[model samples]
Target: MSPLVLGPLVRCVEATSAAVWVETAAAARVEVRAGDATGEAATFAVHGHHYALVVVDGLPIGAATAYEVLVDGVPVWPEPGSPFPPPVLTTIDETEPLRLAFGSCRTSVPHDAAGNGSHGVDALRAYAMRMADLVPAEADPDGGAPRWPDLLLFLGDQVYADETTAEMRSFITARRDIDEPPWDELRDYEEYAELYRLAWSDPAIRWLLSTLPTAMIFDDHDIRDDWNTSLTWRRAMEATSWWHDRIVAGLASYWVHQHLGNLTATERALDPLWRRVLDHEGPEELDLSEAIDAFADRADQDPTSYRWSFVRDFGNQARLVVVDSRAARVLEPGRRSIIDDEEMAWLDEQVRGGFDHLLLGTSLPFLLASGLHHLEAFNEALAAGAWGDRAARFGERLRQGVDLEHWAAFQAGFAEVSRMVVETASGRRGPAPATVTFLSGDVHHSYVSEAQHSRARRRAGAPPLQSRIVQAVCSPIRNPLPRPVRFATAFLSYGVAGVLGRGVALLARAPRPILRWSYVRGPWYDNNLATLEVHDRDLRMWWARGVVDGDDHARPRLEQVADFSLDAPERSQRRRKRRAANRSGEAPSAFARRRSISST
Candidate 1:
């Protein structure tokens, strides 16, 4: 029997259940064994590729158990002669604090000096190595429970279908003519399957997947660059004959490999395709290739027919709302929205505050730099014919060119969501959360910012904005922006871009935004992985990067870049008193960033 092609990846874990996804070399019955509890699922084929998701149930809440995968009564994972530590599944518990790891935009290539020099060292791989050689007692000096992430939220670009690695290019060159339309990039479902195989086959990353429960949402490069940015862009893509096949294959393979793994057992039960496949009663493996392919095609044509977004509540600890910002966009000429009416309505309903924290996960940051936000909103006005037909055309081109299709560019949607956030924070929607945080990626840089409601509203005896609204972004888990490009981005987003953008806005008679914010932690450009620890009275965040020590690319050390402790209302006052008492000391830059929040 050939080896397992890809997974044993733990996905969508609940208190008592966990979902494990795996891809096989051929059709087989896969079994996940944890102690005496076992869940068996037969592999389903999609265009000749086989995959399965086994729902492992009856797991004790917050218990750690060694798990193994068996294919056809033969052990396939945790290889007999494997050198790394054994993989284990740690079930989640609602009573404990939630710690989540999040990042986006990783490109899989070799981990040698050449690859590290070009794309930067892989943060995820380094983290995996750290997890493997961990000394549990040392990790927690007090001898209490150690800090292990409950889940990993992959914001986007898990696989770059549009950008091919050297290995992928070699495979493409061998099979097909490279001088053709797609060139080195992927062309069909077979190519995409191979791309995913290359991405996940790395030993360290594979081990990380086996142990960690991951939740993923796609961004542009998952399909193509600037996908569905505007009506014209969509039209241009639809004009290409190859685009149809590319999109169908991308969504189909994604459904089988990525999106299907994100759903819970309950959500999977409601899935129409899953329902049809489950209706099959047989001892043999079920082949749903045609059905999956048809569903992908239909979803591509009518995005509203299938909803990609979902909500997960952690027993009043927190609520996570992961939205599909790309496909669910309303990209008509006259009216454009980041999410369609149906999606927006669903989002509005979920944004109500009931949990301790409300996490809005979009691949794009909702709260960008104030300067950049103004520029994008200004561009939207010009594109909406505020100036005239000629300027509108120019605005449309500029919008797609600079990649300004974020929440700011869709003013109506941005305003609507902003209002919803205000309502939630002000206790109008429901009992207010301690913090409303927007966790996002896709700018290739990471930062944390806090929104400041105007003091004028408070002066007028209006209810003070009690809840903290924060934006925490982590991006480019491996890919780093070029130095020159980084300089340009910083200058344009913070300096000349703001003044000129606002001047254009005034010329076009655009209205001002409802809120303003400033950076609290960073505008750091390292390829990083970030972790968020949600406490009862504070949210602590940290970013770590891979440092390849002395001639060893295989074992890169994880180093912290920056960290912040954002306090809740009562804790903020206590922290302020402590800071004031120690005001004479010269604090670090990260701590200085925190001190500035008081002025806001």
Candidate 2:
């Protein structure tokens, strides 16, 4: 067997440099060659697993070049008889429009009829096939072929450590006593390594990752369900013997597998841990098992010590700020927040307006469906003893039981971020962008919502809102909610839930949300992936799902689910006037032309 175990994933690409990551069967040097540029790095050991992140520089800006991977100086990638085209690394071009693909929540399973029947087809795989032109293109309902994405942003839940599949469970059973604490859920670094292998090993998806640059941040499932929902929850987990090992390993594995590649070469050079990797020159593989575990432990205990959130700029076109909403949370009672003070300050700095578009990627949606947002707010209030102590206990139970934790649940953090967004949109921070958009996943469903200052706040003489404040969510690139649960989710997230949530909030005396929003499209429950393209002053977005034809489950084709464009402010105002003149009560799906294909 080839020494390469998993990956060769292209990550964190800039105008002239890129990072390629790989896992090897044993300690060995990994090399990447693209055009005349070549980079190599020796494998680092973490709990017996070997990995390398080769930062290739000196490539011409805005150029595309096929790359080859070699392990121990022997060509190992573009595997013999591979069906996919040679993997290419394309550097960012400031002049070109930005195309980004994003989604979250995938479970690893066999790509066969049974797997598709159980979980749904892998939308990412279908997208990869479509990009590779392995699957014949059908007539797109929204005209023209889709442009290739400059980057793939995985919002969160790249692996479900808490929800193990049969394969993961089997591996667990073979390694340790399954009947022990934590059951079949992942326990340590080795389990995490295997889980990632299962998630990324599929041929088409593997090839796709090897070519396109990717950025990732973890959500709760990356550690465990509701990993740090509250101080009470944290205390309970700390009481358990297994939680320590589980957390240490989860975070340590994340650093090796996901977080390291999220950083730009410059950022990595500034990272002390990464500096250790670069400075090491010993003959044996530089073991990071103890050092990384210590770092993860410290990071979990004090999020202020290290930053997981990152910012990337697409020249003057766009700024992508991916926030770490899980580990950086302030979970103490009476002060619960999505992110602590230090993180919030960092985010405040990064969110300044200048680019044509401002994209904030959070694992949890910043603005959820109106009703659900209110519901979560009410829960937070009740849990904070807005009612009585008895009610607080009930509220805590309900919060954990139903997964009521989100940005809305952390009111202080939500309000602060809201202020920053409002300020940025109103041009107080800098030159306002055409749109301030939040890209998120974790809801298991997809939707689009537009936010505006509450009427009263607008009357309070807030600066004229210039940018379109919108939230677009795409989730479950593979894992779809069961049919029965989908009905309940829809009900709770739409009209009825909205009314109920507001009433509950009033009863609890919860602070009224500063902004009000309405759904522009969706609440669609499909295993899908979504993309955004910057078109001058306008931004276009669309969602697509994988559809298996006949029994060719392995060769699923991409089917469009929704397509819409957010128009420039002037165009949107005119369209609104036209709708009003026609006496249309229906909410317009987009600020511009829109198209959608109903779920089958």
Candidate 3:
């Protein structure tokens, strides 16, 4: 086997510099050579795994350059006779339009016929193949052309620690007792390392990561489902004999595998742990296994001590703020919030308006369908003792049993962030952008919803909204919901759930939400990936899926599922019609004909 284990992933790319990460067979000096620019770093050890993130600087702005990776002076990348084109590093240039692909909840499975028959096609893999022009011209009417994106944002759930696949289970069973607690689930850094390798090691995906700049954040399944959902949930998990080690290992691996590369050169410089790695000078490789474990433990215990949220800018064109909605949560009773006080304060500083567009990437949707939003809010009230102590106990059970934990479930956090977004849209914070959009995934479906402040707020003198405030959700890039469950989810999220939620809130005396939103497209349940492109002041987004031809599951073709343009005149007309229909009490089914693209 080659010494290069998993990456040479291009990360945190900027006009002047870029970070390239790699995992090696053993500790060694890793070097990235691009044209005349070269960057090298010594491998650091974490639980026997060797890794390095070499920051290459002095690259020309807006340029793409082919790069090669070498370990201990031996070229290891661009594997002998590789079919795909050589990997290239592309830097950001503000004048150019910014495009990015995003989605969440992918399961690692074989990319052949059996896997496609079970979990549907792997949209990310299909996209990677399409980008490389590997799909036959006959498969795509557009000639299988490539439109290279500026970045690839993995919203969350890069790996499902709790939901192990057959391959992952085999790895687990070979090393430990399968009947033990947390059975079939990951337990330590080694397991997580394996899980990541399985997820990213596919030839097409590996090549995609090697060339495109990527950023990621974690959601529940990265550790376990409903992670940090509530104080009671946290307590129950903490009481487990194995939970401590599981959490420590999960988080430690996340820092090294996902979070470290999300930071830019300047941001990494400010990180004390990264500073320790960068400033180390010795013949021996620096080992951080113990230190990383301690840090992850402390971070889990007190989220305020560390921040997982990060910001990236595309010159003055746009700002992408990826929030740590899971780990940074405050689960304390009465003070429960999606994000703690410190994180909220930090978000307040980051959510301001200035660029042509503002993008908020959260693992969970900030705005669900109006009905689902109210339902979650109602559940939150019941769990907080809105009725009685007994009811609160029952509510806690219901909240966990069903996943009633989203932005709406934490009213305080929701309201505060809503206010911040409102301020930004109304130009109280900065020059209002053309759109203030929340890009999220976790719902296992895709949709677009537009929001407006409540009439009460407008009556109380909130400025007329200048920016289009919208929520675009694209989920399950590979994992599609079961057929039966999709019907129920659509009914609840789009149908009577709104009225049911409002009535329950009235009974609980829960305060009404300050914003109203309606779905503009989707509830489509395809396993797909979505991309957004910013052209001057307008933004266009579309979802696409992989379609297998005949028996050729290994070579699925990319097919468009849905497309929407935020500032399109037709969309504006549809929004007006939707509002009129809502006021007239028309059923959501009546608006189905208005969707821009038909579901596949």
Candidate 3 residue lDDT tens string, 1-600: 899999989989998789999999999999999998999999999999999999999998888888899999999998889878788888887788888889999999999888998899999988887777732212222121245778899999889999999999999999999899878999888999999999999999998899889999999999999998899999999999889999999999999889999998889989878988989998999999988999999999999989999999888889999999998888877888999999999999999878889999999999997777888888899999988999999999999998989999988899999999988988898898889999999989999999988878878887788888999999999888999878877877775778887888778877777788889998899999998988788788989999999998877888899988877334466668776877899864545555523523
Model 3 C-alpha RMSD vs. true structure (Å) is 5.4
**Top candidate by TM-score:** 2
lDDT of 2 by residue, 449-468 (tens): 99999887988987778899
lDDT of 1 by residue, 439-555 (tens): 999999999988866454555565666678999999889999999978866775564677786687677766665666778877899999988888875787888889998889999
Off by over 4 Å in 2: 134-146, 574-600
Worst 10 residues of 2 by lDDT: 135-144
Best by lDDT: 2
lDDT of candidate 2 at residue 92, scale 0 to 100: 93
> What is the alpha-carbon lDDT for the whole of candidate 3?
0.88
- Model 2 residue 234 CA deviation in Å: 0.9
For every model shown, what is its TM-score relative to the native structure?
A: 0.93, 0.95, 0.93
TM-score for candidate 2, please give it: 0.95
lDDT of 2: 0.90
